[model samples]
Target: SSFETKEEQEEKMEKSEQAAAAFPPSFSVSEIKNKQRRHLMFMKFKQEKRKQKLQLKKKKKKEREALGDKAPPKEVPKTIENQRVYDETTVNPEDEEVAFDEGTDEFCSYFNGLTNPKVLITTSDRPRGRTVRFCEQLATVIPNAYVYYRRGLALKRVVPQCIARNFTYVMVVNEDRKVPNGLVLCHLPDGPTAHFKVSSVRLRKEMKRRGKEPTEHSPEVILNNFSTRLGHSIGRLFAALFPQDPQFVGRQVATFHNQRDFIFFRFHRYIFKNEKKVGIQELGPRFTLKLRSLQKGTFDSKFGEYEWVLKVSLSAVTVFFKMQEELCCLI
Candidate 1:
């Protein structure tokens, strides 16, 4: 029986060895831990790569800001800075300074010639150059000067045909659309150049009725577009219809400068009335000359001389706009 027991034990040991030999050495606990560590290291490396990309983007933005750059990706509508006024010069800078500093910050004061029942703008500073800046100047001079205009024959012309009379002031804005939150009260002249305060509800209703949205930035764009349009339209019309006229009107274009002020930023129509064989400074419409000192809320009302400066400025702006317009057209 002892011998048989010994044989049985040997047989059991052999079976156990065979089962162990059938399987190759498996992964150790330490090996599995090492594999996991390698994966985590790779994950950390990828995270660092992504962090570097983000850091690069931030650095680029900071560099751009340091270089005084602005984002050029916003879509905008037409504005009021585009418009026209007569050409004149020799503006008394003193008057402009005084008005801006001392006068009430309103536009309606410019249109002082309003009658009790009728209206007409009569600011010391006749608006010139960019219509929007002119309006702003007028507002700065007057308390509540306004410029209002509506196209087509549907809207009834105001009772005070011009821009003056009883409650506040109104002027014919000559613009295509009403400005949102815009307020320009002026004593408007008769005919087309009128201004009025638009009732919010009415303006909203009109926009809704026409299935159009009020501009998010209409004041600046509408005015600017108007001036540009006027410039182009006048240029085309004069070229086509009045080609034979001796004293010709040049292409209409609004000019601007980087004065950082409202007037400086405004785009003005460059009206160059020319005379055959006449030099640039030697020709212009005959306007009554007036001189006055600047006061608070008032300035050199030399808007009549706007044309002279425009002609001079055109030499510079023409190049910028020519290429720009062509590009815009292509786009």
Candidate 2:
């Protein structure tokens, strides 16, 4: 009877071992009291995860290969631009009212070739270091651009003087802690001013693999992804910065690319190496601009009417309530 009891105990122990093997211990590395053991377990867990991921990828590849041409198309990763909500303000080319508005806007004269662009570049009072260089470099990029000292004058006063001098555009670069941080672009005589928060300013000296000094020839301006009515207005504002006629001989290009409400400015020089192959080299002084507000008139912060102002403080749920208030009178 003792021998039989011992054999039964051994059989139970074997069954317990098999059951334990079937369902492995459930645990986390954090539960381990030993530091070294915890680290080792964590590394093993990471390796296991990676292994599983690789195996799954391999399985998917095999399935795709087996399906061949019949396989469903690969899913495209979602991005803010691709997944953006339907915008009611998108410009339609056939809209006559929009055409009329554009035809009579402040930058219309420049677009119509009736008046040449004369940009007066100035900085915030007492600009130092990079801010000064940024203005100088901006002047170099834009044709007929003149750099002027701010002299601690009020923008309202400077505006009238600029109008008297026949300057079409006034660009004021604002700096903080000796770093260029803001920009104000005002179209003259009539109105329509844009304020932008500037960031990621990469000057010529800071760039790597930059091309030689840009030529004096007027560069071709390219505005990309400006689809909405507001975007179209912003695009035109930048387009009016340069002369309409571009010098093909210069091979220089200035691109203002808008994506997810941020405007990225890039300068480059391109060369046609072959019929199909072309090479481009970057010319430096690149920066990013996020629009703060677009005003209907000149730089009057007090009385100017805003066409659009970026709402950062409001939550997404408040948008519907805000829209309802705007449509209250009509309702």
Candidate 3:
């Protein structure tokens, strides 16, 4: 390549400065290099901004596709509707026995030797009037059950006392606004604590009479509309409240209603020996309970479906024998 001489370069620079100055005084020749650098930087900034905008647009498109413009329809499961009958001939006396030895290795054996399983119904230390009343009512409903105020006793202390006293279950009534709104059921020795929502509690007087007033001697139980794993757990819970070998000669019958995952419990005694053909006696209280939520290991409403909190815990097993007894009557 041919190189320009110093005199030629000087002449070219003078000509370029003259051309720039002829346009406007504000367009200074001395600022030409700085202006070129600024222009290049501005172009790079614009390119980066355009790329970011395109990336955002793509992300928004993906989100729209994933969510869909319209939601899909929900699915409903089919259910069976029928009345189940229990034959007296199928009752086996030996099957009614609950062997605590099956899973009692880790816990003490006080409950194993007890002839009657007891339930302790209690409220929080500072229980409201409604809670206290509910506890009393529940104790009456459950056979061999009694009520005691917690009196600020910690769970660590309460649990050991219950075990020592041969109590099979400890029921805690949680209150809100002076009304029983929640229940905590803990199986003794081995745990699998269950939390349940309490609603629509009615005494016998509060319920609408369907037929003749129930007899006083006959005992009855009703399990209404409980289905699935949780339902099974609840049904067993109800069974735990009663004696294993109940006086069936008095015509004790537990009616379970299993429809749409709702459980209704009615305990009464059935009699069909006399000319009346069929008769019923209210053995336990009438109440409706629905399992809308639960927590594993322990009962804490604040961590379940009704609330947003996380807590750790364990398992549930109690009603294998009751379930077998009711299986024959399931329709």
Highest lDDT, which number?
Answer: 2
- Using TM-score, give the best candidate's number: 2
Q: How do the candidates rank by TM-score, highest first? A: 2, 3, 1
Q: List the residue pairs that clash in candidate 2.
A: none
Give the lowest summed-lDDT range of ten residues in model 2. 20-29
For model 2, state the Cα shift of residue 205 in Å: 1.3
List the candidate 1 regions with Cα displacement exceeding 4 Å: 1-51, 55-101, 104-164, 175-331
By lDDT, the candidates rank as: 2, 3, 1
Residues 18-60, model 2: lDDT tens digits: 9656432386659889999788777877777798899998999
Q: Candidate 3 lDDT (Cα, whole model)?
A: 0.60
**How far does residue 300 in candidate 1 sit from its true spot (Å)?**
17
Report lDDT per candidate: 0.32, 0.92, 0.60
In model 2, state the lDDT of residue 176.
95
TM-score of each: 0.20, 0.81, 0.49
Model 3, C-alpha of 19: deviation from truth (Å):
99
Writing each residue's lDDT as its tens digit, candidate 3 over 1-331 gives 1598888989999999996555333443455578886576557556766988999979877776787866344346553543334223332223422223223421223324454558888887799766676677566556678899888987667878998998888888887887677777776756546666676666545555433443333245556544433454456556556666555565656565655444565656565778867876664445555554444433433442332122334323336666767897894
